[model samples]
Target: MAKRARPGMRRKAIVLRDIDPPGTLATNLFRAVYNPVVQAWASGAERIIAAYAATVSEMTTDAPADVRAEIDGAAEQINRLVLLLTPDLRRWALSVEGYVRGRWRGAVLSATGVDLQTVIGPEDARQTLANYVEWNANLVADVSAQAKQRIGNAVFSGLSQRKPAREVAKDIREAVSMSRARSVRIASHQLSSLSGELARERRREAGLEVFAWHHSRKAHPRQDHVVRDGKLYTENPALVGKKVDGIEVRAAPPADDRAGVKPFCGCRERAVMVFEFDD
Candidate 1:
């Protein structure tokens, strides 16, 4: 007689199998930013692979064959990405490291007007970068764990054959949907964190204002622009054109092409300029 495994147990096993790849999964575990590129670069490839596998597994649970095929494809993609990155990042890291030592170090110091002796020092910078890489690696691992848990829960939930089969499909779909949305949000937050650090470093080296342009062209009667203290304010035309003190207002080409400056919007119309006094 063939031994029978409970649906829940079988589903759980399948989920685990899909999540856990065979062999050493820690091939590219280092951070590319700090490590000698080749030594510490993860290429974000592992996360990508895991995400794809989770997605396909959730969608194809009803068809065991499809799930298995998807897993194979995901594995291949992961391997290919890692293979391509191994040599590329290694060479890049060496080149970048050499550049930093030969020219970038002096240029960065000179441009930022930061005294190497007064601040944390070059040795400290390297240490800080290393710490950052390790922190991110830990974060990735935690996220991966949570993702696997979600997949397991979904698979087990669907294993209840007592429920309508469509219900199971719906459960799988919802689980995959939530997983993808959450993953995107988490990745976005991480990227934002990194961007913030880079921005701070740039600001510390050279004090400057960073402004992003937002587009607003609904072309409604209620829409109007107003001038405030050296800036533009908007609400409705009825509230616009109010006189203000110590400010100059004029219009110029909307698309600014000054060296080092780029226009934020594609609108070819003229943009109002507002200048204000310190007082």
Candidate 2:
């Protein structure tokens, strides 16, 4: 933590090369969001299976009509499942966005020894946060769409194959699990991306044009991102190869050009404010 600053005075910047991400918070949010959704999905899967089994005793081998109608209804259950969970997602999005913003502010304060709230007023903060609203919406939409598609595919493919009720139920269970895992990944990635964006905007406003690159150091990190660790970057990357303080942009450029960083990249821009002349 940075020391308390007196009114009308600024504290010296901390010599920190790596200001870590809000990993704990991110993980907690993932569980908070994933667990309930998975449970609900599990229940929905059960309902789907139940639909197919309602007339199980009447079913005979190659009863194609029963499989088609019953399993189609099963697919519809997934649609309802998405609708059932969407309201909760809206609430989750709002809360997670606020939490990520708070974490980003804390990271800035710790790295630069400046109070972000003091520098970034309430209106500016709200406006900056508001600009990223679409990201949250994307979370909701993508989850819903993917869930429906994956489960629908499982149901339809099983129907086409004329698989037994038990086998179809198995397929649905696997699909629900797959959907949950994919949703978790999307949630975690978006949080990382959002925090990275917040860091860039807030740091630049605080006269922090240069930043120390922080590699997440997670398992199986990208080769390029690993090489970027502990280096410095400017907003302008037109000169990627130019060395400043021995920064060599030999690593491959990010695939996404929108933010000068790629989604799920896990790297962060820690504000590096130079406070005094070198001896």
* Clashes per model (N, Cα, C within 3 A): 2, 0
Model 2 misplaced regions, further than 4 Å: 1-19, 31-37, 54-116, 236-263, 275-279
Query: Which is the leading candidate under TM-score?
Result: 2
For every model shown, what is its TM-score relative to the native structure?
Answer: 0.32, 0.69
Q: How far is candidate 2 from the true structure (C-alpha RMSD, Å)?
A: 5.5
CA lDDT, every prediction? 0.32, 0.57
lDDT digits (tens) for residues 171-235 of candidate 1: 54454455445444443333333222332333233222221122223243111221111232222
Would you list the clashing residue pairs of candidate 2? none
What's the residue-level lDDT of 41 in candidate 1? 16
